[model samples]
Target chain A: MKSKGALQRAIAENAAGYFFLAPWLLGFLALTLYPMIMSLYYSLTQYDMLTEPVWIGMGNYIKMFTGDATYLKSLQVTFAYVFLAVPLKLGFALVVAGIMNQKLKLIGLYRTVYYIPTLLGGSVAIAMLWKRIFSSDGIVNAILRAVFHVNPPAWIASPKYALYTLVILTVWQFGSSMIIFLAGLKQVPDEYYEAASVDGAGKVRQFFSITVPCLTPVILFNLVMQLISAFQAFTQAFIISGGKGGPLDSTMFYTLYLYTKGFYYFEMGYASAMAWVLLAIIAVFTAVIFKTSDSWVTYGSGD
Target chain B: MSTLAKRRLYAALSHAIIIAFGVVMLYPILWLIISSLKPGTVIFSNPGLIPESVSLEHYVKGWAGVGRIHFSVFFINTFIVCAAVVAANIVSCSMAAYAFARLQFAMKALWFGVMMLSIMLPTHVTTIPRYVMFHSLGWVDSYLPLTIPKLLATDAFFVFLLVQFMRGIPKDLDESATLDGCGRVSIFFRVILPLSGPALVTTALFSFLWTWDDFFNQLLYLNTPAKYTIALGLRMFMDASGNSSWGPMLAMSVLSMTPCFLLFFSLQKYFVQGIATTGLKG
Candidate 1:
């Protein structure tokens, strides 16, 4: 069919391509794919790293649902966080983005100020600061005492308020989502606003009718991303709660619990099961969003 | 009032609201800096925005560090790991990206799809098995676990990002280079890598920042006090001091944030562009 020279050339190109891809291929096989399959297998077995894995089919999953109160607590906490934090963060992001989208002279400076917390939000330093600021005698309480002359509870120490503090911390780092919203806002054409204005639309009415519809796709994206990340939030909880998920297990994020099971408790099988469940949860949430998106998400007319 | 006067009033109102929000947003960070400078005994007692007096005592004591391991060591260790990750991600990811972007290879579409999927797949799924594999190899309690996987292009985000950037480069240049007797590898090095500067910088910046901020892997892999990275060291400092030494802890926290602040301020454009493109496209 083809000339020998052309065939040789094709072979060389294939070889080169594979050569370049070798690193990722090796990593995928060794690191991702192999580990994934092994994790799934491990979830069905009870193996501490010290001994042989004893297979008991679906035992770990059953134990998680029925036997483990901590597991249920973690699930409850993570779901609550995902539901609470994601909406609050996205709402703040959208509102801040709307404000920043105005033709203000100091917008850049404001954006930088808003985004700095997010830029450093994941680090241990910020987490440490969060712990201090929410403590009984910390700056937050001090400010409350000074201004409002009221005795505020130790937000991070109290079992009731600890998780809420983490939620507040999550909301504080909404700047990345805000930045994304700003970019999406820039893509929204000005002609729509002009046309709406010509039709005697008030600001509030235009925002709900035109702006919200146009930004639905961005909203969906932020919501899903934030939901996934919020479900796995660990560092803040780890540092704030001293890696115990305590003040009565109120702030035990799913990933934090999984980490403890894997590393601290050495219940590798249990942790693996948790990981798989997390995957399923994320998958279901993403699927639900995508399925529901047809009701609300609108691509530009050009699409 | 004239329409122009009304416009001025609206602008003033907008500025006031934005500034108020900005102050609230930045108050904590400002407090950290001010607390770091305040006398150790008065940090919690004096919650005023303005410090009554300033001292650099915390900086001096914190830099001396706990248990004879200087804070400088943690900084150096973090920098080393971050540099290795940045270098590794740039080389391995760009090579893979080049293959995906330019080369017509077998099962390229399948591999690219797998790569994209990996980007969304959480690290927790792979972490346990990777730890086991690393442990079996006796690579646990070392930088190998953190840095070696990076060399294998395990971070699919960088590869995907580079692929997106490289696809925008016109293909005629690659063809021209091929005509000029440049081999594929040579073409990659000379033509593609050079032109993909912004993407490479983006990769490097993100790789460095992520590696620097990474607590989990560093916490898992580095066991010794001598090998502690900044994140681990900061945790250790908090544990060691408890609530007794707020001044030094605040000082070290400020120091820990300095490099990130510097990078963000200097290369803010790239950071903004990186976030926008990745979020919008994904």
Candidate 2:
């Protein structure tokens, strides 16, 4: 009887907790978990929205590897983009952040100016701006004609240069990563720098030893986040390429292609398979980073 | 040079470099604004910052929009969606965060872990099934698919952010509220909610901006020009005009970026603090 009473009390105590968590729990099941299961099931079949899913046991996955060349090209383009864009962006961000972190006048104003582009980078407007500015007769070409006396190709329209324009767009919006790095830099104690200087260390040496070691955690975090986002890059490529991934498919981002297949072609099953592959790629990359993080990432005492 | 002189020189050099980069960084936006004000005929010919002749013709044309649907409709639609999303995220995320931070639920650890993992899970993995589910429910092309999921706290980023903030609040406040014969709900209303103002503001601001900037879901769900958000409206304008309407497009582009600029300038403090805390802690 006492045990039964205790059980009742426990239930009453925990009831409010469950009540508070109800919305999120329900959402997780409906929007996230259930959808994930259904997506997986769809991946193994052939289906369009108009008809019932016909079982096809790994056909879409097999086709991705063996049958389609555009799929292969998209994979290449996306991987190239991720590798190039992530490093250039992070490097540029770190450099700017180091400058921004300095004790200088009007630093806040400079930070704001630098950050404005990142605020609008994801918009269709900026992508449109990028597309025009890199066109054959646009501002960039006009400037090249006057200054260098040499003709420049229409960067966005050229297959060789199209992907780089996208890369440049990604790198231009390095402000968010820079802001995060600046925050991390501020948390590093001045004492460490002072002590290093007192021990006859130069600025470069102090930076390499004290600052780099301290910032490895933030660097790791930024790397993983940037990597994931870069893989999923869509808006710029989509808008700039006129939603077709044209110029000989040089800028066919993985997400854009997935969007094309799922929405435009209405190949639901194939899109589902592509989505699963994307998930696996992201998971593997993340896991690899986490596994390797022990060598480079150093947690502070509070952490 | 003397030590003081050397320090001053270094500071000046740093300032110069920052200013130079700042100019390069802001050049495209400046060009866009300047190009928008130029007369439609000479916008491409005079690709310089200084306009040969100024006019508001493009702004007028852009605001008139393509067909009979004005830019005002898109603006209203976007604002409605943003407002709904912000309110929903704040309410739903805060409640779940309060539970995780203070309440002693069974399976709390498991739930918290799942929430964190969900933060990393890409939306693409589930986009297809969710799209199908919403389609079957007859929510497509309406604001329901866009707004309803927010009510259930589908955005786990805000949930985790609020959880982190709530955890930092003094547990003694809850203890005292209980002492005053306050129940869990009353305690939440009277103490926790009021004290979590900054984090709540952070959540609201991001929710507002992200919803405004959202394109993928809006593109998928909103097909008709009548129901279009700003992003979709811009896309429609692009498709309708193609390369022939550069001046109007630039004008509309500048207008589309105005809200984010206003929010960033007005709430710089919260923006920086929110980013710092979230990035550093994560």
DockQ of 2: 0.64
Docking level of model 1: medium
- What local lDDT does model 1 show for residue A177? 90
lDDT of 2 by residue, B1-282 (tens): 997998799899999999997898888889999889987645664558987678999999999987678998999999999999999999899999988988987999999999889888889999999999999999999999999999889998888888889899999999998899998888789999999999999899889888888889999999888999999888887888656678787899999999999999998888787877775211
Give DockQ for candidates 1 onward, in order: 0.66, 0.64
Instruction: Give me the displacement of residue A145 in model 1, in angstroms.
Output: 1.5
> Model 1 over residues B42-153: C-alpha lDDT tens digits?
5764567798888899999899988789999999999998999999999899999999999988999999999988877878998898898999999988888989998889
lDDT of model 2 at position A207: 69
TM-score of 1: 0.97
Clashes of each: 0, 0
**Stretch of 10 with least lDDT, candidate 2 chain B:** B273-282
- RMSD vs true structure, all candidates: 1.7, 1.8
Please list, in the order the candidates appear, how each scores on TM-score for chain B only: 0.96, 0.97
**Model 1 ranges off by over 4 Å:** B280-282
For the record, the alpha-carbon RMSD of candidate 1 to the native fold, in angstroms, is 1.7
